[model samples]
Target chain A: MPIHEKSLIRPENIIRHESMNLQGVDVSGDWSTFIGSRTITDYNEDMQDEIAALPGGEYIHRCWQCGSCTNTCTVNAIEARFNPRYWIYLIRIGLEEELLRDKDILWQCVSCNKCTYTCPRDVVPEGVMKATAHWLELKGHTPDSPSTIFDREFSNQIFATGKVEEGRVLRRFFASTGQALRQPWLESMVIGLVSRLPVKMLLRLGLSAVLRPKTRKWSKSRAAITDYLQQQGRAERRALHLSAGEGTHV
Target chain B: MTHKEPTGDYNGFGPGWKATGLTPAEARRATDWVEAKIDRRALLVNKDRVEDIRERMWELEKDGEIVVHRIGDQHEPVVARTLYGWEKKIPTNSLWHHKSCGQCGNIPGYPSSILWLMNKFGIRYLDETDQTSCTAWNYHGSGIGNVVSLAAIFLRNFHQAYVSAQAQGLPVGTYYPLVHCGTSFGNYKEMRIYLMHSAELREQVRKILGKLGRLVDGKLLIPEEIVHYSEWLHVMRHRIREHQVVDCGNLRATIHPACHVYKMVPEDVIYDDTVMDGNRVAVSTGLMQTLGAQVIDYSTWYDCCGFGFRHIIGEREFTRSFAIDRKIKVAVDEARSDVMIGHDTGCITTLDKNQWIGRAVDKVYELPVMADCQFAALACGAHPYKLAQLHWHASPFETLLEKLGIDWQQAKAEFESYLKDVADGRFETLYDPKRAITSGPGFVRQQGDQAA
Candidate 1:
């Protein structure tokens, strides 16, 4: 019941024979080869619609599979899997299982809009990629991306005060994203800057940090914008099938 | 929307009626000038609004009695009437200066350079504290800001410009709304189109602003057209060259036309290849060409510097990689550029800061990246370290300055000693970097060789 000599080797393209006598020739260099096949079973059919429901993703249906977006993508040249065309195909056909394989890298779209500029059909693949990233977080597939955290803090300052003070935004962004304030590159940039800046200018910059930059008489406009954004948030949530008040205050 | 005179009611005056001293005739004239200044096609919803407005502007010019300055295309050469019987689109009188958060915060040299050139040209500009940052950065970066808030801010800044001009006894449109940032220039253009295109958006914004006491004569006042400061530099390029104090003879300049300036509204972007004997393409390129620089064209001229808003702060990896791979690498390897002129702050910062990391990582290519105004300041003989502030930028320009026959080391040491004197209170507190040096370049060259 056992081929005794052949059992010594692992069946990974190996051939073994204790004794071989054939009528013509012993012609077995490779035998016992192992092959594997895969089947995709977890297709979530509503994937495209969910991404499209987010802002910047409404034009996903316009892609023509020309691969222009991927070819022109600034990130794609450096990374192999950051292909917008492949993801759009996986998305359009509801290959949710396949899409999840690239989950860790989906939010890395740099938003250069080169893809958007090159897309003949106006697919706006940069926007689609952003929306896709937003969808991933909303659906609990990934945690808040560093980009999301940075954008949230930046937007918050603008909402509170009609202007964004650069120093304030940088500090808050670094804090929220768990990054050190004294990053080597950032410190180097500041050192170069302050080395040449006059003392009066330094005093002025320090004053802006203490006083903070803002628009005059921004109360009414700020209140209106807050209401409008809240309404937009509720609507976005409704489309995603989540509770209206599920997330933290944006 | 029809252009009808305000018959008997004066209801059209809205909140503007509160201005105490104006008689009926004076008010009517002001209203007519305001209405006449507007590009009617800008207010109308249409597929071909830009060209349509241009065509209609010609028709109005033919029929009307006032020999008015055409509101848009102020940067084009044809507006100057072939150099005689002209209006200075680049204003020589005092104009209000709108500050940019990005310019003032990230690249302090940008504003200072413009001020230096203005002093050189005898052009007067006012930096007003009553103005505010345009706030377009947040709106475009994240979609958190609604149309209403942006509209309110736009109205607020332009209204301040108009009111200040009037207080100085100049017309409402006299100061010309010189936008300092490319993003604000483009964002305001987009908002203008949106405000004209959607009645619902406009009414919502109007109501919101009216409550905040921003409605002028009960109407949102839109500027004739937004003019970027880079455009002003382009218009005066010839004057700058003929009067140039320093010769940038051996330099080659390549321009990175900030995407926000060229790509946002492609049709409205100034200059064409055919405009200057198949040479001029953008304001930066045009101005550089006029300065006798050997301007080079590279393959990645159209690529963004990867400022990508949040990508700079959050995705530092992509920002740095793209800055080197897409932009600086092409400029250095392909064009062999001496200096790169970028119009926007983010693009300049992205290019200027990331080159150090590029060298650190063994990706070794180099070029000094700076604002177009900074280059203009340098060419007009502003002090390299003090006024041009090359010491603050990451991309070193000492080699380029040495090529221009200016002593970079001496400039640095002199400025350093100046700082020490100020620290010791041995010199005057008010230091002016743009004060002209009496010695010629040859004399400076001799002094530089001796110092070295």
Candidate 2:
């Protein structure tokens, strides 16, 4: 947590004392040339193998690192580090280190899928970005992000009840985010007031978030679903390695 | 054999009633009439769809359905008791009304309805200046405007709202929480969350916003609660339900929640699909249920009402195709609901007003269209249904009301009184179109002239 003056000197660190033209030109000349030159060698080939294993993995090999995906990205316009162009370039070259550096950038995407929709050859750049980001988190190279939170708690909700319980998801989300215990008084007050309201009244106030009753038939299905996902993940990892081997020979 | 004679409130009692010797025009009027009479049947037949889905969504409801944490079902008890009644803390002093131009071009009174409701609740709000349209429609449609531009607009409006609220001694974002065009609210939330997700987007938006003014210390300018006017009405349904003091009697209304509001955040939509529970959420369906109307679930329940940004401006047919498949055909042939009640102005206009265009092109759907508020207002005895602005669709769903014995004369009186109270500065506009018009590149060119 200690601040180091030298930390400001990194290649990606472009100090902006004032606003600069964002039309691909830097009036401050602070645009990092190094962002383009960063080596693709830091990446492990296994990362590409892993990404080619997702639902929409066919589009992975289709990208040739054209900046069109990045240039068209609405997220990239604001968060430069969250560049699809750079992420795709890393995946293309297997630069695992650089990919991991900006893994948090993936969460910033609204999943509007605009990039995928506009892609020339229908390459799903968004999915590829997500696949690589997920891989980084699985390897412990990335920190917790919103998508991870949603995926974790949502999965837990479904995993436990075989269906999502809204009240549980929210409660877990709040507690996991450290907002639950920290705001104990607020929580208590909410509980007290909500408890006093009529059930019908609560539903009308958009409190359906907390009022969903449980599905009675889901208890037995949870074990089967969990087993299926685990088995699927192992099978996918094997298939990815085989595909990567084929790519190397080609 | 036909079971209860199709409830004669809608124009065409039920299926195949079109063959009943009524002329095509007469049949259209009959369909309208039949739609008016279904509310009486709801108390006996309607159930919340969420409860049904919750009961059946076995896989989706269980915790530990995945390999992550095996937190057992600890949240079910909390989720079962839906909360509706909240102490009325209406802020009428100063409200920073953010606007939407798309709603303005289509249905003008959506904002007016919000204002009317605000006055009814005696909540003080500010309809002030120096605030602009979130410009969300133009930006999202063009796919050119980035988070910076969006956040700048959000900050400017929130900043003005914050300052005004503080001037009145209220918390910054508390009193003036955003009440926007349906899509605008969804877009704002999406953009804000996305920006916050990346420190980079947050910093960039902050830099741009800083030029306008500081976000204020110790007070975040983000809206504390983003309220949709329909949701507000849904919350106050208990008080307003009794005022149905007007009798829709048996009007059959199919509630349409805007896709952007629910689809943009599916996790937030609490209503069910399999079950018919309409009173479980602050959504269109819930409000319709509260008004004592019958809500039918036709197939294609989740399809977009098809006012896709490009379709509305460039390709009219494409837009109609979405609307036809999603609303018109389903409302008539499948659900057999008489009228489609909409919560968003855009959806209302597309479903209600645009039907005539679809009809002229031989893509006709004979359903009366009105907003949930307009419908609620009608049920409350307010009429002429001022919110019945069908941009390209025909009007006079009067036949539907007539079938239910609702006097249009009463509706006209209620609507006129509502507008009168609004013009008297007694209400605050929740979804203002003129205000939305002020968001884009200065002037709205109305499809032909160059914008200034």
Candidate 3:
């Protein structure tokens, strides 16, 4: 696994001073890029097993230290902190505290599958990233990411109505996220679209908002899907030893 | 001798279509058996159980019972360049248009260009109302969706397409689904493999489908192969030139292959360089090359469009930063591309909307972003504003359209005239962004739009 020249150390982890005398030795300046010592005693030995129980985390044991996932990761290319291989390693070694340090940014995985595509060992690091994210929320290491909130909102709409209206989803996501619907960029986008969109087309889009498009006689299908979803939620929670319908705060 | 004269002729096809392998009932029984012995939790955790299920899936696929597609040995670029010569997977004439949520909402022209091109080519297609958003957006962005629920929705949508084709007197296998969104294209393909691989999942999905009355003749209607619409365009590049209304000989296109389409399904993402004069890119770039456009490659060509769907609507900073820093800057500095063409709606939206914000930071990368179909439509002589919907895009497209010989001034005037007739809500959208700027970065509120 050829790790790139880019070091995995975060700025916060770097311990430095303008000038320092470490035990009477001048161990400061450019040569003294000392990393802070990490104290880790809180280890969840079952962390890997718990994540493995979740959908995407099953292939964790297969990773043979291949850094291919991070090398090819789309998100990793931009935000170097979002490394799949490093996170997978942390999960495997049961470094729960260390893993938690990166939890907030973990859910940013775009599901690109480059990790899965590049993994020679079939570790499917993409799935592991997803499972780890799900794992964090279930074990109460982190609160639900905005990604999850958006997912829940969008899924609920689909379960209720057979399909989603884009306008409805966008507006509902903004509202639920407690953000202003009048985002400057978003407004500029809508304004430009409204200016040119044929009146008939605009009306059609507006009308869908009023009478949301749905599959005819879809109640049975919706009921079936919703029922399965609830069962899954409970089972996943049960795997992590949490009560159904409960988060850490709750 | 008389007994030999009467030969048996029971060709298995049509209304009583029994391809092979386990029937729906038998598959259900096998599922019940698996659940009784080992629950799905074990399957998710235990590699032995996972392997056990994959064996059964292989059996079904081998016997031609449950037709599923594997990327085989090829990546998307290879498949795109090679498959058109023989692979029956990429359907040209008849297709089922699976609508995209983002494209239909934000870039209306995406779907319009696709439909417009299909009609121009006399390609018979079905755009049934029953086909829904792949729901992958919800799944990936929020993690609200589980495998079972997503599978059920996938089956429900594709069943609608299948039934629609049946009612139209077309053969069962005539119209393969041409997915509009990269997310749906990738998600459905994954779901197909999942369902085939696990009998437990198959059984669960079967019960759900049965409860919903979506089972096609009491059997799961799995297509032999799933393909993205871009593949269709790439396969039909030869025919597209025959119907080309405008010559785009001088234009240069740099493609932004949607990650969801290729990166997720790397092997299945068509890969054929020879098809485009040795240029290795997705269908968009290949299609452009066929229309006499020079398709260029640049660094960060494989980058995500920064939609991070949830991030775009919720965490704006990440989307903005990634677009300018990783995607657009490379496209401009390295490729020096005339236009940045993308296939997926999320990609197009991210690229099209964020370029202006990039300029605010004094970024030099401001290529006009558009969906591949919109680009194709423009090359085929479609109007920039009316057909291609360039007016909706934030990127500067007047120069690009002019280079292609489109009357940008007349189109802008038409757009302006329509802008004058808007009563309230639409007109109200234009004012606040400037107001936000004047108010500075912190809690800028408009007259009615209060900052939350």
Model 3 per-residue lDDT tens digits across residues A1-250: 1112216655565444557554365644432333333446576788888889888899899888869999999999999999888888888888888888888999999998988988999998888988888888877778888888788778878888888888888888899789999999989988998999898998888798999989789899988987887777777788888876675311
- What DockQ was computed for model 1? 0.01
* lDDT by residue (tens digit), candidate 2, B363-406: 55678877776666656544345543222235447677776566
Worst 10 residues of 3 chain B by lDDT: B430-439
Task: At residue B60, give the lDDT of candidate 3.
Answer: 79
lDDT, candidate 1, equals: 0.71
**Clashes in predicted model 1:** 1
Residue B112 displacement (Å), model 3: 0.5
Each predicted complex: what DockQ? 0.01, 0.01, 0.01
Interface RMSD of each: 24.3, 24.1, 16.8
Q: Compute the lDDT of residue B199 as modeled in candidate 2.
A: 53
Which residue ranges in model 2 land beyond 4 Å of their true spot? A1-250, B1-96, B166-174, B218-220, B270-282, B385-393, B409-452
Clashes of each: 1, 82, 13
Cα TM-score of candidate 1: 0.52
What is the TM-score ranking, best to worst? Answer: 1, 3, 2
What shift in Å separates residue B261 of candidate 1 from its native position after superposition? 0.4
Name model 3 segments beyond 4 Å from true. Answer: A1-250, B1-88, B166-174, B275-279, B414-452
